[model samples]
Target: MEDGLVRSISSGLSQKGVRDHNERLLLSLIQRHGALPGSDLARIANLSPPTVSAILRRLESDGLLERGDPVRGKVGKPSIPMRLAPDGVYSYGLKIGRRSAELVLIDFCGDTRHQRQLNYDIPLPDTIFDFVGAAVSEISGALSPEAVARICGFGVAAPFGLWNWPNTSDESDAAFQSWKDVDLRVRTADISGLPVTLMNDATAACQAEHMFGRGKEFRDYAYFFIGAFIGGGVVLNNSVFEGPQGNAGALGSLRTVGPNGESMQLVDMASIHQLELRLREVDLDPRQLWTDPDSWTSLSRYVDPWLGQTAQELAKAALSTCSVIDFEAILIDGAFPPAIREELVGRVRRYMATQDTRGLIPPRIEAGSIGAKARSVGAASQPVGTQFML
Candidate 1:
């Protein structure tokens, strides 16, 4: 009797271990492939058919996943797919930019259910923190307390040098007066009461692209985000290339020659903010340019010359970068709407098609799939992605 009881206890512990391992594997598979069939999960997770069946049953019982109807294929039995339950978990993401903050709520499957944007005029650090907290509260209030309790965490895509302000010498500190000595992570976490994962806006945007957009096809690529700043992120072997001190792909600092032989940083040449200012100078409101077809058509003619100049600088940067990293592609994504993006991509592609680089493949240039919300959406995935860390 004593031996039998010991054997039963050992079996129970072994089963628990198996369950835990399968749970993690299942979640990772869902994250990677979105929704997949049980057979595919079994193959990806390397679990036997029986084990996969048992695990899926247990997971469904726990409300972590739901099984859909069997899908019929050409030559095989209909296979039922399993998906992460929409209500199983929640994540909040906040993208903090120079002039605006975007808040997004995502489910375990990386689906955005709610999003809001808050604009400010040179917001102080305190106000930024308050705004993020209020956004979180607003999102949380929409759900039940029980559902809110299932929230995984929050991710913040903050400005790249937010924490380095104080160390930039007393003179530089005074120059960036509002940003100097701000502890964004600690203060924001205190207000939100959730574990915060902070990353540069461009880095977060790249992460979003890698997981859900065009970069999903390549293991290595460079993602350039042109918004208020020309930001960038590098993916090496399907992971973010976070350099020492977590500043790997700050591409905005790359200096290139602009139109009329003037030197300017890539940020100055490519950022939407600069384009907006130029539009305003021409007595055209950028908001109208974005929405009205006639305004866009007129704006396109003005933008083409500037875009050609920007494309030249971008090509120079890409050539230099490709010589070093040999990335599969260099993707350009911006806060510009789809129509504008298509126009820019068309011009960039035309330029790139003509350039000849020796002994290296010319990197493909394409518009970002996630559009303007890439950073916020990428931020939403951070918490859930980190949970899979060993």
Candidate 2:
């Protein structure tokens, strides 16, 4: 009787281990390939056909995966493609900007289910956290209990400087003054009751483009995120290179040469803030200018010179970085509309065409696929990506 009991326990443990291994493999496969047939999953996962079949059955039973209609080809049996069930899991993303913040809910497939934008009247420290916490609670209330339960965690995309964790006496004193230095992860997690991952807004935007946008075509490139400020993120070997402490791609503050051979920061030259300020100088609201075609044209004309100078500086930085990293292209993305982004890309391409650099090939410049929503969408993907280990 003792021998029989021991055999039963050993068999159960062996089965549990196998199930866990298969679960990991299944999740990995779904992440790498958006949707794939069970047969193809066996090949990609390097699992036997029987094992894949058994795992799929278990996952389907658990409501983790769903099968679409069989895709018939010129081959033998029609294969059914499996996809992550959209409602099976959920995650939240927050993009905290200087003037505004965006909250988004994403499903397992990285699709946005809901989104809300909140703007601030004043840049007060206390108000910012209050608004963020309120938004989380409001959104959570809107979703079903089951949906909320599936939430793996929350991802936050904020300014690079905001991530400095306090240590030294001076740093601690500075943290008290700057809201950015406060441990947002702890505060947000406490309020939202979920794990939080904080990353640079530009870096998160770049990852969104890489995973779900046009950058899917290239493995190595630099993503320049033009918004209120011009920040960038580097992608090497198809993954974002978040440096130690997660501040690798903060390009806004990098000093480069302007048209007059004077030193200028990328943010000062390339950001939409410059253009908006220029519009305000001429007695026009930028938000109004963005909507009017004539106002947009005038604003573009006013900003073109600085934009050109910014592009040149950008090219120099791209060339210098690419010489070391050898990326396939440099992607230009911004919070601007498609028309504005296209114009920026065209002008930058024109400038790059005339410029020459040594020891580096000029990278193809293109606009981002998701455009302005890249950062917010990327932030929303954090929870789903983490759950699936993507």
Candidate 3:
């Protein structure tokens, strides 16, 4: 035993876990295709006809799956199709950012049924916990009793080591030091009396894109999410490629040159924070960018510098990432307005064209449809994904 040669009774939910896994596999396929015949489900799931039938029957009885309009043109009796009943399940997601907190509820179809948000300077842990508690309670209380009972769980998305952020940023305060050791998931779950899961804000946003965005069209890509700071994630093949410690696509830390030719992290030149800092120099109310994006359309003089810097850094990161891995597309999404996102991505694309990139395959660069809610939607989608998908 001292030498580490050990034997023990190992235990897990062996039998039930397999059944659950199989059920999720079937459901995921149906969700992807919209609907499928029992025979098709059997073939796709690699299960026998009888086994597929049994699972479908069980799911139908549970109100999670149901018979769709029958395919009547077949030679045999019309083959019945099955599809998901969106009301069968629900989930809650929370995104805590440096500027605001957002809570959203999604149904089986990934549509937000209700949402709540607040914008304020991020405060101490106690204040945050209270806001989360009240937000969860409000959303849950607003749901019908039956719908409330159908909730799968809650998922949280926030930057990792956020409390230690002040050390490097101007926003830092000594009070935030208390967050260094807090277990946010456990604490939030404890107060809400519900299960909870946590993920890096960027990773969660990537998951949302993988499940609901251009991922529906491509199997691999790099995702860059812009907010107070730029962040990103990589999807390899059909899954999120969280390498080693899960910072695989952390584009915020990409090495780049600033306007002054000084070396800097990409976030320093390519994020909303940088844009705000530029605006602050002229005494403009930077919050106007968040509360009213339309006004920015007239401020090209102030925005052009930030745009040029961001475009260069983003192109560099994309080229660097493509050199190591093959991707069908590079997606850019952000908390900024739709017009802002589109223009930024376009500038990045045009800038990339001028760079002396040879032997490196270029992929289609596009905007992410998930937009501002990517993190929250992706966060909530995780619990549903783990519980009901393979």
Candidate 4:
């Protein structure tokens, strides 16, 4: 990230942080369990009735929570249920892919209120920052003063050292070298005047899947987001395993034997970048695939080899990941059209089934529910996650 990030805490805000964390905990519980009664909240939160009541009052007064009509059934007093106020809070997410930038505004219910995408061959610093500023201004129109004020901040998810991938993005090394080693988070914050949190693009997508997609039903899984370059995140018992440098689930970096039995990274075979290379070999316009997959008629003929190679490599990566930490499922997603995603998942599943699983149970393979917006949604979710702790 070109901009530096806002630290998660300030020196004197620990007390306030604790209160906010507790509030977020309650909010998360409500989101997970649906509208909850005060009594149930007290029990679930392990708080006394009075404490829960007080917290509920605070949340209700702040408009972060709303109460349902009192229920009158089999009790001396009717209990009023509470749930998140969708209009009360909003967060922003920015996903900077190798080819484009996306901005999304999400509400408390995890619904995308507004989104905008800008495409470019290579996202130069000035162009991307300008686009973000315009997109933010545009999204602000969709929010009221209260929701705008409630905006936690922008979460940025971009490939680490994105400019270094001249081959994947098809840009001149001389032009993009300036972006190398740049503190994108710091620069983006400076340009946008909003607190920014950074995460690896793949990890951000994984977070999106867990919070908004099928991961809500599975505690452990290996997640792959096959964007321009394939990247992924690992979830262990519900938490994403962000390694020491926050690049833990980079399945793209996993080594595998190539078709010629040469050592190569999985990304070299499975990523959309490599797929584009395959299309270009047959003299097809690669941009058509991303911009308008429906118009790319040659996909069935030209992409078979790409799919076969990608599926095989994906299986290899999944097996390797599962060998170390057995998971309940394997999720695959990317920037492709929905039809293409399903096909890729199906192919990978078949290939994975043919592999040896004598020492471990084969995780169920499936397509992730969230699609192209996963990165932006995940990035935007950071503020919500940080604000709520869950």
Alpha carbon deviation, residue 90, candidate 3 (Å): 1.4
TM-score of each: 0.84, 0.84, 0.91, 0.90
**Residue 349 in model 3: lDDT:** 94
lDDT tens digits, residues 35-120, model 4? 99988987777666776787789999988899888888795899899988987778889898877889888988789999888898
User: Which of the predicted structures, 1 or 2, would earn the higher TM-score when compared with the native?
Assistant: 2
Candidate 2, residue 218: lDDT:
84
lDDT tens digits, residues 1-390, model 3? 111101111234455555676788889888767789999988877777877888899999988897889798647799989988888889888888877788888988788988887776555678777877788888888889999988888888888878645333455566667788889889878976668988888888998888877677678899999888889999887888768876678878888877688998877777888888888899987777767767668777887787778877888888877887877789999987788788889998998898777988888888888988899998888888877887
By TM-score, the better pick of 2 and 3 is 3
lDDT of 4: 0.82
RMSD of 3: 5.4
Error of 2 at 214 (Å): 1.6
* Model 2 C-alpha lDDT versus the unseen true structure: 0.74
Find the candidate with the highest lDDT and give its number: 4
TM-score of structure candidate 2: 0.84
Q: What TM-score would candidate 1 get against the native?
A: 0.84
Q: Where is model 2 poorest over a 10-residue stretch in terms of lDDT?
A: 1-10
Task: Kindly report which residue stretches of model 1 are placed more than 4 angstroms away from their true locations once superposed.
Answer: 1-22, 73-77, 163-176, 259-263, 280-298, 388-390
After superposition, the stretches of candidate 3 with alpha carbons farther than 4 Å from their true spots are 1-15, 166-171
